[model samples]
Target chain A: MSTKNSEAGEGKERAGDVIVETVARLMVPFIQLFALYVIIHGAGGPGGGFQGGVIFGASFVLLVIAFGIVNAGDRFPEGANTAFMSLGVYIYAGVGLLCIIFSLGAAQFLNYGFIPLTTHFEENRALGMDLVEIGIGITVMAVVTSIFFNLAWKREPEEGGEEE
Target chain B: MIPSLDLVLLFLIVAIAIAAITVRDLLSAIMLLCAYSFLMAVIWVEMHAVDVAFTEAAVGAGASTAFLIAALSRTTRWEKK
Candidate 1:
């Protein structure tokens, strides 16, 4: 009888752990979407590129915490994270380079008027702002996640180990 | 009216930040940090930044807390101080 009761208790604990893990998994998509909303709407709202990007990065960090670091790393490989960071910076810098290439003005790097969005200054500004936010979000998310993983994976010094 | 609300929100944010930093227990500090994030979200809302507030609530409250707790689990929970 005691054996059966113990088995039942163990089952309950397993079920609880599964429930927590499932809820954590479900949260990732919502977090990503909310990050995007902040980035895209920052011009009309309180957030901007930096805040949005950090928030996006927080999602993966959450996954690593809620689930396990190994699981999170499996989901987002090192190569993919690096690529996203590079892509974001490239896009952001590429936009500025395009302006220089067009010879619109040398004075400004990210000034949108030089590039011309649909031949309208206002439209160009809006587009440039939107793109910048996107780039920021991507870079922030990748970099922050990388940092968390690096910290988490660092080997702890053995107890009483000799200092290097 | 909105300005008054903003003041309240700001107060809440400050309180949470103080608590988070002052807490001795790592877990408690992390949890308080989440609360601080939430209050900051409210402040963002008061500033007419709905999108920012949403992101703050989702990421700050949701993911960041998880990350902290996860990191905490890998180490000791209590502190000498």
Candidate 2:
């Protein structure tokens, strides 16, 4: 359960002073809130899924830096990351598939207007963009967190090893 | 709107880059790289590329810096002579 970066060895080296930890804990919520705002407002503003997603991932990374890897894993378990990673791509492709299913007299894919949920064509397009953006955000967040974790920690080989 | 300010920032970024490569200690080099990324982000913001600036700051300066620090922790700190 105790990763090298989490327990006695490296944990002691990385753990910041109490003040830094408190500041990091207090700061993460606001950072995440701002990241969400950036994602939702991306259509009109200078923000989007990738930027917001990186910001969200950075917040957890901040937690890891200030506290340790274990705290971060505890807060957001490693198993959940795999789920989010695939689920994000699924959402993106699923939305595209949905557009094809509706077709709406169009032969093209990802035709957001063809979904026909909103009265205005622009609104439907906006909604589709939102969904796609959310998917992008999810994928970016999970991939980044996964990448950082991989770089930061050495993984234990799973049981029933298949390789020679 | 000051062209001189942009020029100054550009020079500072170049200086930081040189320092990042020249620094002997890996930890200081990583810190210098973070500083470089931040200055680069500021330059992007000055050019009105807010989205690019935002991503550069978060991913480059924020996350990558921490990742490098973690990498340093598990590895040797000094560069080979």
Candidate 3:
């Protein structure tokens, strides 16, 4: 955040005790923990990639609300967002490519058994599903946060403008 | 879905939707829409789709409302008559 804005916001925050900020600070960590739990628990539960990712993204949105956009952006820079977004797809596609390599150019694509992560075929399938869900979760999280940032930190309506 | 609870939730959702559309103050409309989303989430939960309810509460009630409020801050709150 710019020094001026930070100073002004801090002054206002100090003057009023900022009950919302305090509550948010106390709650956000638990919310993020739950999101991670949802992501990791997708295999056996109702949670999955998309929902977990959105939940993770909502944490950042909450941060943006409690602090300013600049503060939130500082925590998750644009470059970091782009990197994570691409990394997710890379992890997903890389797993498929690994499957191909395991097949030695003769087996079907995404053949999880060929990779031999586990002794049982079903276990390998389960592992592959976990990896894929993680990839989807990462991609969704970054994309959602990016969209919110883009929509939020733009030009504002001027005085007497038709803002509504 | 329990018929009585489902009916009540659906009714509340419709009422909130109407109030959201008719309110001249954009902020209150946005709040009403959030309430509408919460009710929709409950309805989804009653239907045994816990995953969908989770999503509606997270995206519809939470993030979307925050985004709308952020946008509202940069614009006028009152609608043009």
Candidate 4:
């Protein structure tokens, strides 16, 4: 029974390998575009920061699986990943800081009325929400993508044994 | 709550989760886990949490599955039972 199971597993792996290749090819561009759309359209829709971020992260994960971890790492080097992660956090935190500096008597942090950007409260609220969502999307996307890469890439030891 | 479609989706989710947990081959288990996540995403959508459903679909179904498969490639698939 175990032998039969092993054979079945092998067959499934082979099928998955082929399907992964095809799906990866078809998914990359569409995933990226859809992620962007989610981020932009989130203001008036059910989608928002976290959802868009995950979608963005999924694109990189797909690329890694379809090709190889090494190829994915090469494309998105360690230095670049660090930069993206930092940039995303900065964007998110920066928005809150800006609101504090520009707005007075606002209820709290991220309160759009404090900024006084527009005379209309609704417009200001919308703009503020957009900024926050964008920030969240950026941070979530970069952080999750980095996590995926770290898990996927495994280095082999020189002595012909598994490393850790 | 009594709709037939909801019942079918609920059953599908349970079946996928069982397959994911019971599969001897780690790779197959991981793949089934992905399917389970996709089904859970559908459930979340049905429950009207669209944002949560979207995240579940992308991260749980997509990124997590790829990560598991990649990690599996570098390790043994069969587990002693």
Clashing pairs in model 3, backbone N/Cα/C closer than 3 A: none
Docking class of 2: medium
Which digits, one per residue and each the tens of the lDDT, describe model 1 over residues A1-164?
33432332321222336776788789889977877887898877667776778877887776665655544566888899899999999989988787777655565788866776778887887888888888888888888788777656433355226534
| Order of quality (DockQ) | 2, 3, 4, 1
TM-score of 1: 0.71
Candidate 4 scores a C-alpha RMSD against the true structure in Å of 6.1
Highest DockQ model number: 2
- TM-score of chain A in every predicted structure: 0.78, 0.84, 0.79, 0.74
Q: Rank the candidates by lDDT, best first.
A: 2, 3, 4, 1
**Candidate 2: which stretches are off by over 4 Å?**
A1-9, A12-16, A155-164
- Better model by TM-score, 3 or 4? 3
TM-score of each: 0.71, 0.88, 0.84, 0.80
DockQ of 3: 0.52
| Clash list (residue pairs), candidate 1 | none
Indicate the worst ten consecutive residues by lDDT in candidate 3 chain A. A8-17
Candidate 3: tens digits of C-alpha lDDT, residues A1-164: 34544443422233333887788788889988888888888878878887888888888887777776665666878899999899989988888888888889785667776778988888887898788789988998898888888666642335227554
State the lDDT at A46 in candidate 4: 69
Off by over 4 Å in 1: A1-16, A154-164, B1-23, B43-71
**lDDT, model 2:** 0.82
Interface RMSD of 2: 1.9
Every candidate's fraction of true contacts kept comes to 0.25, 0.62, 0.50, 0.62
lDDT values for all models? 0.74, 0.82, 0.80, 0.75
RMSD of each: 6.7, 2.9, 4.6, 6.1
lDDT of 4 by residue, B23-52 (tens): 899988998898889988888888788878
